[model samples]
Target: MKKTLMRPVGLPESASHPVATPLMPSVVYASDTPDALDAQYEGRVAGYTYAREGHPNADVLARRIDALEGAEGGIVTGSGMAAVTAALMGLLRAGDHVLGGDQLYGRSLRLMRDDLPRLGIATSLADPTDVDAVAAALRPETRMVLIEVVSNPTLRIADLDGIAALCAERGILLAVDNTFTTPAAIRPMERGADIVIQSVTKLLAGHSDVTLGWVAARSPEDRKRMYDFAVTTGMTASPFDCWLAERGLMTFGLRFAQAQATAERLAARLADMPGVRRVLYPTREDHPDRARAQAVLRGQGGNMLSFEIEGGRAAANAFAAGAAGVAFAPTLGDVGTTLSHPASSSHRGLTSEARAAIGVTEGFFRVSVGLEDADALAATFEAGLAAARGA
Candidate 1:
């Protein structure tokens, strides 16, 4: 009994496997011989010897994401930012130039404009929706052009095919951040992106419970380089988080579809509502990049939308207070609907002038539509709008 207690009984192998992938949290695996251990380390065998190097949970999650993104290979990381860092660091060297979209997520923009320069990497920003503008911004040292499928806060859809063609001709890599669109809307890789990044913490996880991210590469060599960097830097994700993300992915398609449908309904409703100066949704007729959005998103407007309230900061505050059922969180992509103030949250790092230049005004609010009744959400927004007008 003591021996059994010390060494837990293992599950006997059976013909039938678990319906759910079993969580293997063991950080280290024992090998029968030194040669076997060496084989595992050298990638000669299909087994894991260390969690930091490669583990079952991370591998499983990576493979699942690769399939979703149509990637040749992928690597999961501790957080969305970690994945971004790994991708950039692995592919770039000192003196390399990166051209990023002007409308990228605030943190992403800061990473490129602020942090990367510290490493001797040069960076520039351009309008991703305008392929020619992006081309004009490119430098001779430019190695990567990073853009998002749907620009944050304003919903500017990128011209992926045009940019990809330009990049191919110039022999530059195109990295697309697909966290907003996910695989439900469109896979950027299919449109000629060399790399695709996802913050699995968002729609892919379908829950706000875990913080995870993944980088999918169109080539195995690129995948290996990023994977090596992630492992060496200890940016690997938790086994438990990967397992949870996998479970979330099971219903991702349904969740995303419902959320997107609801967003479409809300976008139209908000456009007609009082105290709303403007509504920015990919499918909206007035969206500046509507044509590009149609081509990239394939008819789905996606689950995210942004709007500017009539009264700016004070009105926005009042609206937040009045919107009783709806939550006001700084983050996006959850099972329940939530709102975020970009000027105060995501883009706070940027100067006021800079924020306004990108159209993130004082009254701007980004909404992450979730699996909720459309009418109920509309009612909540109505309340918020009334409050905004009063303020």
Candidate 2:
């Protein structure tokens, strides 16, 4: 009963067809009849006229991810940022206002900070963890509220239910970036989110190989709106990328479980270590939002943890370099354990004041626990911490 929703649809019965969906790479379809092409343009029939508009493989992936996210329908995009831009651009006009959380991915924050204003859409950032602050930031022209389920780097858990209810009361659209806590951990749509955005490049794909994004709309109108905007804007995902993401989705359940378990163990171990200053993980007992995370994530702390090294940047660099098998990568959610520095990596574009406001200090380093053995990672951390102290 629990796994049915995530189960991939079986291949159709055929004697010659392969068991998996084939990649449709054709850029343009050949149609002799004008009526047929007209029907495709009119949305009366299901077909692909151009790769930039639609493809069979992308359609399958969208439906598969829609099933996972409990959405009415969805569309795939070229990248995560494309999905975000398309969703916001499709929904908002020149006069609309967007209320965004300060705890967001660096690029997403920058888009709202610098880009949205140039497009004539106004935006303001606030602490989404504070429901009152979000409510206070709302304006008469405010049309949307954007937030992350679990914030990047800091791992702060947003009050999704509370904020969703607030948006509903104010008749505002709630768009949730579910990249961190994917459908495996929390489905934002089920919690009253109007729209859900994900970077399939991260956990859903479960590998660093493919780059793709998706948007799932809870309502049919919203779904059609996003689909139409995607086609017109030409941000459609490549057929091959879509296929790879679906193949990767097959192991998402198992991969996410194992990774989350390892993360919980690593978070617990790091909290008591001598060279560690603090660990920010949702399910940890001492986390400020531990209770909220438990309620929202249904007791899952997710597959990531960020900790502060005692000696700041130098110690962080030394620990990462000294750790065996752990690479100092700029991204997260890799199948192998990897580390990233928020201040110098993801949040490097933000001002020092902006970075400090979000608690991303020079010492902060985030660890994305993979399928690595817990005991082995523990030993690596022990050695790395020693080096960090020495540094």
Q: Highest TM-score: give the candidate number.
A: 1
User: Runs in model 2 with CA error above 4 Å?
Assistant: 1-16
Query: What are the per-residue Cα lDDT tens digits for candidate 1 across 336-361?
Result: 99999988998888889989888888
lDDT of each: 0.90, 0.88
Q: Would you give me the overall lDDT of model 1?
A: 0.90
TM-score between candidate 1 and the true structure: 0.97
Clashing pairs in 1: none
Taking all chains together, each candidate's TM-score versus the true structure is 0.97, 0.94
* Candidate 2 residue lDDT tens string, 119-204: 99999988889999999999999999999988888999898999999999999999999998989899998899999999989888
Q: Candidate 1: where are CA atoms >4 Å away? A: 1-9
